[model samples]
Structure formats: C-alpha cells, structure tokens
Target: MVPAERRTMSPALRRTLVIAILVELAVGGWLLASRVLRVPPALPADMVDDPLLAAEIRALASRADRGGTPEWRTLGEGLLGQGAYAHAESAFARAAALAPQDIDALFGQAFCIDRTGRMAASNPLYRRCLDLPDRTEDGVGRKPFALYAIGRNLLRLDDVQGAEAAFRENASFLPAQFQLAKLLVRDGRLGEAVRIVDDLLRQLPLALELHQLKARILEAAGAPAEAFLARAMEERSAHLVESNFSTDYVRPFTTRLGMPRVLQEVESRLPPVPGDPRRDPAVLEREIQPLEALVAEARVPQRATLAFLRGALAADVDDVAGITAALGIVDAAGDRSASRLELEALVRDRMGDAVTATALRERAAAMAPSPQLHRRLAEESERRGDHAAARHHRARADFHLGKAAYRRNRLEDALREFREAAVHDDRHVATWYRTGEMAYHLGRRTEAVEAFRRVVDLEPDHER
Candidate 1:
C-alpha cells in the first residue's frame, strides 16, 4: 500500500494520454509513409467502397488462423482457389511486404495475380521467387508450382520452347510433366509424349485426365486402336463414378470424381466435330472393336446401354447394319424411353429425315429435360419462327446443362450456365437457387445474395 501511494497522474488520465500518443504516432507514420515512400500500398482501390468485398476482406483478416506471414500466404492461396482474386492479391502483397525474403509469399503473390489473367505483370514476381536468396537449400517448395504456372503463360505468349524449359525444370511435378507431354505432342515428339503418358498412367491408372491425354497421344502416334481402347477405359471409369453418385442428389464430391467435363471434352477431342465429316468411316468402324470389347466385358444390363451408344455412333459412321443390330439389342417395341427416342432421333437425323428427328426430339424433351433434347427443340422452334417457344426451350437446355455442371461441383461453369439460363428465362426458382449456390461457393457474395433473394421472390416456400 505504501509503495502504490505516490502516483503522479490518475490511472484514467494516464490511459487516455497513452491512447492519444499512439493516435499521434500512427497519424505521423501515415503522413511519413505518404511523403517518403511516394507509393500507396498495393491494395484494391475499391475495397473500402465495396461493402460485400470489404466484408470478405474483414472476415479473412480476422480469422483466428491468421497470426503471421505464413498464415497470410496460406489464406491467400485459399482465396485464390475460391476465385477471390482481388482479396488474395491483397493478402499476398501484405505478406510479402512484411517478410520480403519469403519465397512462398512472393510466389503466392505472383500466382494469385497470374490467376487473374495478368500474365505480363506476374512474370517479374515469379522471376523473383526463383532469383531470391531465400530459396530453400534442399526441399521442394513453391518452385514447381511457380514453374508450372510460368510454363502455361509462356505457352500463351507463343514461347513454346521457353514453356518447355520451364516445365522441364520440375520433372517430378505431375502437372508440369502432363503439360510437357502435351507440348511434346504438339511438336510431333510423339515418342516422348507416349513415354510420359505411360509413366503417368502407371502411377494413376484411373485419372480421367491422364487417360484422355493418353488417347490423344496414341492417336497422334498412329495407334488408333490403342487410342480407341484408352478412350473406352476412360469412359468405363467415368460411368462407374456416375453410377455410384448420380443418385446422391446432394453430395457433389463423388460426382466431381466422375469428371462430367471429361465427357464434354471428349466430344471435341474425339474424331468428329459435329456437322463435319472429319471422322472417316474406316476410323469409325475401327472404333467399333473397342465398343464391342467393352460390351463383351460389361454386365448383362449394361450391354443394352452400350448398344445404345453403339447405335448412335453407327449412325454417325453411316453403318446401317450396325445401327439395326444395336437397335435390335434394345428391343423396345413401341418404346417411350428417352434414351431410345434420342438414339432414334440421331438415326433419323443421319438418314436426312428432319421431320422425324424433330418429332422424336420433342417426344424425348417431354419425358426428360436433357440438354440435347431441349436444344433440338429450341432449334426446331427457331426454325418455325416461334421466338418465344425457342427462348423457353433454350432456357431449359441451359438449366439442364447448369444442373449437370453443378452436380459435378464445377461451380464456375455451373454459375455461367445458370446465368445464361437466366438470360433466356429468369422465372425458374430452381435456376436462381442453383445460381446462388454456385456464386456462394466461388465467394461471390453479392451475386449470391442477389440470386438468393430472387429465389425467395420467385417461390415463397421453396425448400432451401
């Protein structure tokens, strides 16, 4: 008590004085920074003005996981993954400023900026990662990631050899090796591409990407039979994933494993561009063996399904007998099945029976809201000059396409498709809901909230 008796100032006054001194010091530091540094901090100019963006920035900044440079870098990487480009750039820039010697921060900053499509601006930042003395003495750090990204941008800039050199620097990185194989293929180095794909396939036999790349490499190498077979294997894997998860309805994780985009990509990668006769009849016939082999290996119930695919392909190749036999496998007398109707439409379309094809597509559209059936209906309506009907059908097609992308957890693609659907017809509650969901996943808070509000307005009691 005696020791504490002689305070020169009141505790409250002392506390207030201390706070005032801190405020003056902070203001002086700000002024000094403005005068001496002569450069504003690397931050988004509209961050404070954009309420939704500010909320996101604040949420990230206040996260308990945030404590220092490493955590900031990690948070930045996560934001980049979630498509929050501006916020990620800010976080990375701050981390790099705090610890100028941090390779991870430097790389992250470049990578985040690169993701925003500013390839030119990111180049120097990426170079800094490689040139820095902060590079670890032994372990693989962000070097491989940086190199792979550089290779991608270099290719975009038409520097193929430079891209190859960058990719080659990280031989063990799978994406780098994968891209290197593609570059080798583009340059007619088929043998090298084949070896790379073979090694990758050995390591990841079930990877849809590797299988698709292998198919192209084999096709490039004049191994059409091998290409056809590899493509079949990829389809088989895809179907297995679809079969397991299509009924889940909510959990998209397993659906993502199915790789729906792979099938779409296959349409482009495969021989025929639709409405173009680039696919040789002989080549198409050669493809029949792989289809037949898959059918032979499949369960009894799957044979008829494979036969449906066989018929559709046969129609494309002008194989009348093959189409007839495959149809016989279906044996659906007076059938109303959507798959059979769709196959019939393809057959009729190939036979130049436009009237019959349109009729069949309309019938299929009634039973199932598939994009194919709806798109055909849209085309038919447009041809008839029924603009409203055409728009309605087109919206349905986009909605269906969006649903497929959504179920596969391709949020960005799903959001795009849903937005397109809305452009055609914005009345559907489900479309709004899905649009909101995708926006939410991509960290598009404003769009998500707006879409959700639209949903509530469209259907008051719609299940969340």
Candidate 2:
C-alpha cells in the first residue's frame, strides 16, 4: 500500500488540486474585499443625522437661525405658534424628517398635525416620543409630555375615554409644578391634576402660566370665586411680564398671553339663573344668539366651548329647540366635538321626542361606543315599546355594564340589573306569543294585542 500511495502524482490530478486551491483563495479574497469595501446601509432619508443628509439639515438650520426669510424649521414653528395648523403641518413634516429625533421638531410636527385636524396621524408620533427611554436624571421618562400630547390629541378626536386614560397615565410625570391644571380639570380628573399644580406652584410661585392654569382649572371645576382670585393674580403677572419687556415686545406678549383673560371674561359674562327656575326662556334665548355668533367666528376649541355654552344656556331656559339648534351648530363646527352630540341626545329626550332621541342616542353610541350611551338608547327603546330593538340595545348595555359592575364586585347588582333589563325587553319570540305574557308585562290587553299584532304583521308566520 505504501508503495502504491507513494507513486508520483499524475499531471492531471496535480493540476486539479492547484485549480481547487486557487478557486478557494479567490473566493476568500472576494469575501474579504467585500467586507472591507462595503459601506453601511444609510439611515432613513428623513433622519437628519445621516452623514449624507447632514449638509442639507445644517443648511436648513442655518436659515432658521437667520430668522428673516421663512426657513423650513422657523416657518413650521411660526405657523404652529400662530395656530395656522394646515400650513404648519406641511412645513413641520419636512422638518421632522430632516431631524427625526429633534425634540422641538417632533413636538412641532405632532402639534401641527393635531391642529390641522389629524389626530390619527399625530398620536403615533406623540406615543413614539413618549415611549423613548429616559436619560434624564429624574429617570421619569417622557411620560408626562407624551401623556399630555396624547390626551390633547384624543380630546381633539372626541375620544374622551382614550384621553382620560392617557392623562391618567402621565399625571404623575407632570413636573411637580406645571400650568396645565385647567386641562386636567376639563378632563374630569380635576382633583389629581390640581394636586400636581399645587405642588408646582410652591416651587415656582411666580410662574404666570401656573397661576393661569390653576385659575382655569378652578373655574372649570366650578370654583368661580377662587378662579376670579386666580385670574386677578394672572392679570398681575401679565402686567409684570409687560413691564419687564419693551413696548413692542409687551404688545406681542400680551396678545399671546391674553387667552386666560378672554376665557375669564367669557365665563364671567354668562348670566346667572335661579335654581328653581333655571330655564328662564327669555334669558336662555338671549344668551344663545351671541354664542352662536361666536361659534361662527371662533376656532375649533373656542367654537366647541361656545357651542357647549349655548347648549347649557338652552338647557337652562328649557328651550329644546335652542338646544337642538346649538347641537347642530356644534356638529357642523368641528370633527372633534362629540360633547355636543351627547348634549343633543339629552335635548331630544327633554323635548319628549323619544323615537328620534333614541336614534340620536344610538348614533352617539355608535360613534363613542360607550355603555352609558347604549343604556340610554335601550331605555328609550323600552319606553317606545319596541321590544326587539329594546332587547338588542339592552343586551349591549348589560354586557358592558356587567363588566363594569363585576370589576367593582357588584355581582348581585349586575344580575338584578340584567333581570330588570329583561322585563323591558322580552328577547324570546315565545314571549310575544304567550297569551298573558304581553298583558301581564304591558298591563293592558289591548296594548299587548297591538304590540303583538304589529310583530305578527312584520313576521307573517308568527302566531299569538
């Protein structure tokens, strides 16, 4: 065997070995070259940090710094600041992509999108920034700012529950002192929001924004006297701000800071009504016309507020027609105003238009998808003697209400609640046909017959 193995290699075999070795070396060389020469994949085109994009971003930033001609960032900021949402949105979108993680750019983009009536678009950006890992010494994450942005966006989208959830989530992140207490109050979580502001006020006593926020919150929570006092303090701060600045500067500053005063004046001007006769028709009608006029000229938030005020005035005067009219105005004023829709349902109920009211309530229920709205609609259906419709609405209401009650350990209450619900809506077809079912339930044979007769008429094969 050694003798055979040791024989000299053949020319063809030697050539093959050499060829294989050369191929391997060639492949290895190619791989090594690829590794050394290849560039890393570029960051997203919009991300301003990209080396390739840095020059363009720097150019834009320089232009913004110049501040005379409208540069991308400055134009966006100015439009956003001035509440020209649609224009701001276009500008900020460009800026955000150019500087992806630029906090001001992100905030401006999100705010402008939201202002331009695009809550769905704004929410994701707010969430992304809010979810960013915290590097601050406090380690408190961006939760507060994120929560506030989300809540504001939800409010604009007419998602009250979603807004509440977001506000509650970041309520703790609010700088132990900030000036948005009023927003929290309007959110119906006033107590918690107020506590945060109170702590902040202790630290930054001279902060005009805090005082204004506190006043607005107090006013929203129905603490008029405290709000008035807070307003006075804020006014003093406004004067202080003006006195500290040049005349030209003061005028612009006051114009920007005058929201609190305008709000206070509006609240103060609302006429008081007597408790026993809250709905003084004349006063209600008188108050509504001006509010309607305001609705026509106001922006989204202001218009929504005015519409709500008009609705309240109409309710005070027991003017169903006025209330209905105000609701229509509110509905037309903005896509984000659902509170007005809710008020409209109430007005319809008060007007004794149960059938139409039920439909309106159902529409609201569909939009907000709330248990309360469903319950109201179910009750209205029961009142109208539409057992089938009543059953459907009641089942939906009971399903949600039961979950709510069960979470609170009210099992018996939930069961009784459903049982009571069943009395109003006999779901089974047999309930309609049983001889005494309708009579006993309705308390009148003729009424039962009429109801059953209608059911039978609709369902030709049904028997009584």
Candidate 3:
C-alpha cells in the first residue's frame, strides 16, 4: 500500500484541487493588492437549515462534549451520513480516544477516512478494528464490513492474492462474495465463479448485474445455451414487476445443477460408448418429458430455456422430428428477449441454416451489444468487406474488453483498449471517462485531462 506521506492523490481529487487553486488565484490576484486573503473557518452544521436536524446536531454536540462513546459515536454516524467526513472523523476520534474498545468509533473513523479515498491510511485503522474483540456496531456486525473494506483496499493497492484471501474470509458479505467471484473469473476459474454466482443468485436473484455477469462468464465458458439462459434471466431481472424467488438445482441453466455437461456431451459428437444411457433414444425421449413439463409451467425465459434443452436432448438421439418440434416452440418462447433470440440463432446455426441464424443474431446484437457477439460480427462484417460496420462493432468490443481488463487490474492493457475505443467512439461519455481513468492510472496526465474534459463537455454533471 502507498503510504499517506508519499502517495499521490487520485486524478479526480487532484483535478478538483487544481481547479480550486486556479479559482483562488483568479479571485485573489487583483484583490491581494488591497488586503490579505482570509479564508472562512469551516464549521460543523454551519449551513444546516432543517430545524429538527439542526437542533439535534446541537444537542449531539452538547452531549458529546460532556459524555462518552455512545454520544460521540452517534454524532459521528450522523455527520458521516450527511457526508461531513472531516467532522465525523474528529467525532469518531474523540469517541475512540475516550473508549478505545468501542468498535463503532474505530470503524466509523476508518470508514470516514476510506470514503476520502485514502485507503492506505485507513487500511491499518480497519485492521485496528479487527485487532480488538469482535463486536456489533449499531445493529449490524462489523467484522464482515471491515474485512470487505480491507479487501477493497488490498485490491486497490494491487495486492490481488491478499484481496482474494480477505474476500474468501468474508464470503457471507455480498460485496466480498461478488469480488471473489470476479477474481475467480479473472483467473479463468470458471467452475469456481459459476458456483459463487449461483449462490449469489440464490440470495439476490433479481440482481441484473449478476445475471449479466453470469451470461458473459457462461458465454466465455463455451456454454451458449446456459449463457443465453443467463441473458434471459438478465432480461427478467430488469423489469422486476415480480420478484424471482426460485433458486437451487431446479433453477434453470446452472452448470453443475443443470445440464452443461450433458449439452457438452451432445455437442462433442464423439462416437457414443456401446451402452451410454444418454445416447439411447428411449432414455433421451424420457428425459424430454420433465423438460416439456417445465416448459409448460415456466415463464418466457425459463419456458424458452426448457424447450431449447429438450430440443438439444432430442437432437442427441437423432430424433429429427422431435428436435424440430421442440426448437419451434423454443423459437416462439421468450421472443421479447435478445437472449432467447441468440439461443435460437445458435441452434439454427448449428443446424446449418446460416441465413436465418445470421438475421436473428444481427437483430439480437442490435438489442444488446455482447462483446463476443460484436467481435464475431466484426469478423463477419470484415469478411463481407464492410469496413465501417466492422469498425463500429470492433469499437464496442474494445470498450467492453477494456472494462474486463480494468476489472483484473491489467491497467496497461485496459489503457490500450480504452484509447482505441476513444478513437472510434469519441462522442460517448463512458468511453471518454474510461479513457481518462485508464490514462490517469498509466501516468498520461495531459491525455487523461483531455478525455476528462471531453466527458465534462458531454455531461456537465458527471463526476469521476
């Protein structure tokens, strides 16, 4: 970790400070001739206008001056919630000084410091919170959050293994679990990531990001049907008109709990073993019953998924008529989603109907810009001598690739990708912001500032 004394401030913080300095210089340049500059002393709750809140703040201050840990801790929590980090830090410090064993005070102080982006300084303070006895702050346990904070700091410091270990220890904490899964994905531990994501979905089935992430991971793992199901889940999560309460083996599209292995066996097309049960037409037809039942009972995404799986199983047994019938239903189900369309396209492509598959895929790509799909489209477009279309698809692919690289702390690669993305998609705020962030990390200050200025120009309210 970079020590406070030697650590350089992040680009966003530096830019803010630089702008403030310039404003000060501009205002003071002529005014200095007449009188010395006098800065106003920042006071706690100075501008608070809500009568109840202001009175409460005053009361907290009064009690804290004469009282101990609880009063100061309460005041600190209040200030922290209001984004008054400096005042909160002081309050928490006073509380910790009076009662060093107060986990709340220690955590509050460390958290206030962490919010300022001084992770190196706050890391040890979080460790201090842990060094003491395990305790609860307010109504929640502190250990999990503190461990998560430590892992976050470790990741920021580029201590990948340390972060992984910390996250592993704090697996029950959702943030820690998410980080661990991301790390596993970065390391190409797809099996591990698959399990983690499955568990996370069980807890938070409606998390759109997790579904999207699983889609990407499954796609990368060469499980297109399962990936498509993940994308289907992604679409379902977005509406959230109804909560998805189902989770577990019965949940569709899981790798271990579902049928990626069976699908893999079918897709491999190796000579069947003499008595392989899956290759038996009778057994395959029997397996189709449960899937047919599932399709009947399930909704758009899951119904589509079950139909596709049934088709795959029927195809494995060379039941051409059965496969065609099942796939026809799969094609009709989940028609509103790109995932369903993509899955249908993949099946059609596998069945040698390239023309129809291409059309469906192109439409799906337009709906949701999948990096892998875009990359394939870019290749196909280039083959068709459509340079402009290829470039556009390639640029989108580059942006997402940069994001993946950034997630893994591969900063140099991320910078390259974002720089390329910036060249193609200059009007996009996300591209500029990503470009600026990567440039700043890679020590290209001028480029970073220019990209940041472009982002600000595009979206004046954008911060970081």
Candidate 4:
C-alpha cells in the first residue's frame, strides 16, 4: 500500500513541476520580447558628420522585407527623427497595412501628418488609435501624445474649451503644457501660467524653450526685468550656448523639421510696433547678423525662409530698401513665390498703394483662398465703409470656417460660425441650414426652429 501511494504522489508532483516551469518560461519570453521591441538602435558618431547616413539606414530597412515586424516600426521612427517625413510616412503606412492593430504605426502616421502641417487631417487618425486597446509601452499610455495632438488641432479650429480639456488631460505632455500656459497668459491668468512654468522648470531645469516661454509670460505680466533675466537664462542655458547650430536645430530629435520656419512666421506676423520689447530692434539686429551669415553659408531652403524673415524684420522698422533687398534674395530662390507675393501685397496695402494692393490681392486670391484672409479683407472693407464687399467677404469667411468646424465635429463651434455667417449675410441659405442642424443636435429646439425658419425664408424649396 505504501509503495502504491508513493508512485501516485510522484506522478502528481512531476505534473505540478512541469506546469510551473512552463509558466516561468512564458513570462520570461514576454519580458524579453518587450525589452527587445522597445529598445531603439543607437546612432553612430559618423551620422553627425555624414548627414546621408539616414538614407543609408533607410536603404537597409527597405531590405528587411519583414512586414508587420518591429523592425519596420523602428526604422520609421529613425526616419522621422532624421526629418525624412515623407519616407517615414511611407514606412509607417506599410507597417500599419501589415498590422492593422498596431498603435505605433498609426501614431507614427499621425505624427508625420502633423509635421507636414496637416494637423486637422491627423485628428481622426489619432482618435482611432487612442480608442484601441492600450498597447503603449510607456507608462502614460497614449493619452499624453494623442491628447496633445488633439489639443493642438482643436486650438487651431478655435475650440478653446475643447483644447483646454484635452491639454488638461495630460500635463506630462510638454507641448500641450506649453500651449496651456500660453492660453492662460492670453486669458489674463498670469498667476496660473507662472505656476505652470515653475512646475515645468522644476522638472526640466535645462529646458531653454521653457525659459523663453517664461520670458514671454513675464513680459506680458509687466515684469520687464524678470523677462530680460529669463531671456538671459535661456541664452546661457548649456543646451544653447554650447551649440554652434541653432539651439532648435541642434535638438533635432526633440523638434519638428519646420519648427524654425514656424517660429519665424509667428514672429513675422506680430503687430509692427517700434519699441515693443518682444520685437526689440537691438535683439533683432543681433539675431539677424548670425542668421544672415548662416543664410549665405547654407544651401538649404532654410536660407530662403531666413531671407524672408529678415525682410519681415525690415518691414517692421519701415525700412523699404532693406525690405526690398531682403525680398529680392527670397524671390531669387523661386521657392517662396506665393509667400513673397503675399508679403508684397501686405507692404503695398500698408504703404497706401490701393491700386497695386488690389492687383496683388486679386493675384493672391487666385492662387489661394484662406478663410483668415477673407475675414481680414472683410474687416478692412468694413473699416473703409464698403459694406457690400464686407458682407460678401464675411459670408465667404464664415461659411468656410463653419464647414471646417463641422467636418471636425465641433458642433457648437460650427453653430457659432454659422450664426456669424448669418449675421454677415442673412440670405446665406447653407449657413442657415447648418445652423438649424447643429442647433437641433445640441437640443436647442427654439434656436433650431428659428434657424430653420431663416433657411426656409432664404430658399423655400430647400430640402432637409
């Protein structure tokens, strides 16, 4: 009896041992795969000296031929970091086609779109990826990046509250945090913006961008001394002072390819004021000397963009000859024709050459139609008491803006846009229809009925 019991117990113990071993092996395999999948390849020192290394790396990736694999996704990330956005987009698209469930591919595609200035078009893709199961290896999941992207696009669409909510969902996202601080400053909530900047500085003491941002906030808050000190700190930051390249360019992996151009564009659009510290003449002169040298030395499109920026600075000071000289350089480049034309129109309009300005405007309108430009034209026409033209342009601007908002599913924003269109031109039947539809969905029955009545008044045979 004892021998029989021992035989049965030995079989049972062996089975239990086998099960435990299998479980351990499974866990170990998962851990190894996770680590291997998450680690990015290190960049070689030669990559710094040889800018073409990115192309070589991409060539190697093309030979991998392992669709849906981690290798393709990694290569996509590397290409994106190197600013080959079109190539990176292709790689990500291939990966996504191979593995429809892969969030990384989807995110990469959306990121590339944003880099290419298609932020609004990337929104639906972001929403789809974020709705997937949480496969993000990072502890924050996809919320930080997705919310940041959504918030940025929403801000562009004029959905302020929606943008604020999206940004507030992920404070760890530095871009969104920076935007939030800017919004706070814009809304006169200086204390809140300052607190946010302080918190960010505590986490990233070496962040020169944050320092620059803080400088802007302080200047807005009437602290010129503090603002200047912040700028000094930004300039002295090791990340900037240690670099021969532009601080933004040196941190290529942390910034988008067109960041410098975007920053320059923003600066160019600032209201021309002689002594505005934000556009200080002394600082502009200091900054442009290096940029001018770089433009002469560099052979990239950045040179043309920089030349345009210099022209913009000259325009700020009403230096017509300086502006003409700078613009001539940009015109010679042949890449900024549209932008050059727009700038010429602006200068002519500001200098009170209405005939030339009108001709430029007609040319510009033929090239591109922007809601912002139309709205500006409307405002200018209103100022000149050209009510008919103002009404026409206002109707065009609001109609376009409303349709854009509607496409983004910003119903309330669309409603407001449509209402503005109606205010500008009550006979705009499409605007009245959209207003009624949006109001109905929002459960404002009375407003919906009123809007529908207007639509019927405009077009009696209009179908819902």
Tens-place lDDT per residue, model 4, 208-282, is 777887898899889998887677555224332111121232244432323344445555644456567767655
Q: Which candidate is the best by lDDT?
A: 3
Per-residue C-alpha lDDT of model 1 across residues 1-464, encoded as one tens digit per residue: 55665656788999999999999999999988856864322334443332333455445556513366776765575455445577768778878987988987787788668867898789778877877655564555666666667887888989898999988887987778888888898888989998998897777666677778789988877898888767755632332212111133123212121122223233344554445464555554464555456335333344565466567668766777777777777764334488787777776776778789878888778887789778878988898788888898899999889878765646688789999999998897878887887787688999999999999998988876
On the 0 to 100 scale, the lDDT of residue 407 in model 3 is 62
Q: Against the unseen true structure, what C-alpha lDDT does each candidate score?
A: 0.69, 0.57, 0.71, 0.70
RMSD of each candidate? 25.3, 26.8, 29.0, 21.1
Error of 1 at 420 (Å): 40
Sort by lDDT, best first: 3, 4, 1, 2
Residues 304-323, model 2: lDDT tens digits:
55667777876766778877
Error of 4 at 41 (Å): 14
Candidate 4 has an lDDT of: 0.70
What residue runs in model 1 are displaced by over 4 Å at the alpha carbon? 1-56, 59-84, 131-141, 238-464
Error of 2 at 459 (Å): 26
| TM of each candidate vs. truth | 0.40, 0.32, 0.42, 0.42
